[model samples]
Target: MKEARYFYVPNAVTETELPADEATHALRVLRLKEGDELFLIDGEGGFFRAEVALTTSKKCVYTIKQTLKQEPTWRGGIHLAIAPTKDMGRMEWLVEKATEIGFNKISFLDCKFSERKSLRVDRIEKIIISAVKQSRKGWKPVVEPMIPFHQFIDNCTSAGQKNICHCYSEISKLDFFTEANQSLEEDILVLVGPEGDFSFDEVRYAMEHGFKSVTLGESRLRTETAGLFAVMISQLARRV
Candidate 1:
């Protein structure tokens, strides 16, 4: 049997037409025509088997043949909240890789030392959607709007395991992997600071508010790298 082409359609259903971008890919790029079989992912844990019903230069329509629900292979959720980097490309790269690596959600932090105060949420979301389709992931990671660091901390609910990864050499910090392995909480939230790292006061505040201080490793990592490291460790912990 031929491998089915996969498309991302957030609200896919019977008789639903493919979105503009997806339609272009299906009609112009893939040259799919009526009766061609394809798969659609709604990015909310839904997989749909669809058959092309109509195709034109600018449009592609499909009818759902079957709905396939997929369960997550990994246990727990990985939520990484980090300050956006000054370079937008770096931030986009992190988002793409994190989604492919399988994380549940991502949030941006505006910290004391943050260089970038704003972000293009819409563009970043598109990157995430593309990554999801490329990785063949069933679920989509939520890209939350950028908010002040203090606001994010204060509004955080008292659930799951929370940790802050920073460059505080004086404070005793446990290896992220080690801490994650010993953690009993299934939902994990990790806070990573900006290029200059979190200020001493910010770290102290987070620690006071139930956020444990942890270290990724001895070598210093950039904001994006640290965030990805935290995600990987959190994911690995669940498998152990």
Candidate 2:
């Protein structure tokens, strides 16, 4: 028997043909043949146990054998918003790790002290997809385009406990885990700053706008690390 493989096929519940890129990978790279087992992930919330029905140089068709709907691993929603670091690699690494741990969404914030103002969201989306496939996560985390720090806060009026992590001592900060644990099933969002950290004014603005000031711990962490730490802590809180 041949080994089974998973492919990201959006709307796999209805669509029998894999996307062009996935089709190419299936035929050219994997050399999958007709009747090979294939697991299809729709990225929304459906998984289809399938087998290759037909294959050509550029196309791979599949026949669904079973339909499965997966339950989310964690209760509530975990959202992490962060300022992009100068090196794109660090941000990409964070996205991969956080996705593996599982989260509902991730957003990029253009902060006051941010070094890199712009980033390729498309490239980051690919990383998220790959992570979802690797971890066998049922739902894919949503990645938003980078937006100004203030603009994002202004538009975000959703129902959830919002927390912002920063380095200033003058402003009071709370323990992230303890705070996040307060409402296990409620949606939670954590904001992490850039290398230089959010300016005092930005911190004040967030605090004034209902974003609680929270610290990951006593140790100072880089931008990417802080983001991942927040993600891990949030997931842990929901698990318990």
Candidate 3:
């Protein structure tokens, strides 16, 4: 049997046809017609086996034939918070790889040394949606806009398994893999600094607010690389 085409559709329970963008792709690009088989990913851990019921100039109406509740590959959520690189293309690549590797959320940080000030998350979200479908992931990762470093740390005070990857020789640090391995079934959040690295004050503040200082490794990594590494470690740790 031929594989079914997968489309990301959110809140499609009561909806009849694909959204404007998805519809255009289905109609013009894929040339999907009535009676074609498709899989709808709701981005909420739901996989619906559906049949094309009807097709209009810009619509792909579908009737769900089966509902599959597939479990995520990893055990708990992995939230990667990083200071986005000045070159957004690097961040986009990181987000794509991290999504394919498995992560739940990604947040941009505006650190004291951060080169990039503002970011539009809509484009990043679209990359995430595409990655979800490409990777056949059960859930879609969220892309949050950049927030001040101080505010980001403060807000995560109550988060479970909070860790920060930094290179502060004077400051005591734990290995991220070791720390993450201990909390297999808990939601983990990791903070990666910018290329310029986190300021002493910022690192100190985060440490004071329950964010454990951790090191990714001895080798220095770029901001995007650090973020992707954190996500990869979190995903691997959870599977252990």
Going through the candidates in order, what is the number of backbone clashes in each?
A: 0, 0, 0
Error of 1 at 151 (Å): 0.3
Error of 1 at 186 (Å): 2.0
For candidate 3, the per-residue lDDT at 178 reads 96
Candidate 3 lDDT tens digits, 1-240: 966688999976778788889889889988998999988888888888889999989778999998888887887789999998899999999999998998999999999999999887998988998999999876998878899999887778554898888898999999999999985888999999999999999999988999899999999998888888888888778873
Candidate 2 lDDT: 0.91
- Summing lDDT over every window of 10 consecutive residues in candidate 2, give the lowest-scoring window: 1-10
Candidate 2, 88-207: lDDT as tens digits:
999999999999999989899998889999999999989998898888877889999999999989987998889999999999899999999987788999999999999999999998
lDDT of 1 at 185: 48
Candidate 3 shows a clash count of 0
Better of 2 and 3 by lDDT: 2
TM-score for each predicted model, relative to the true structure:
0.94, 0.97, 0.97
Question: What lDDT would each prediction earn against the true structure?
Answer: 0.88, 0.91, 0.88
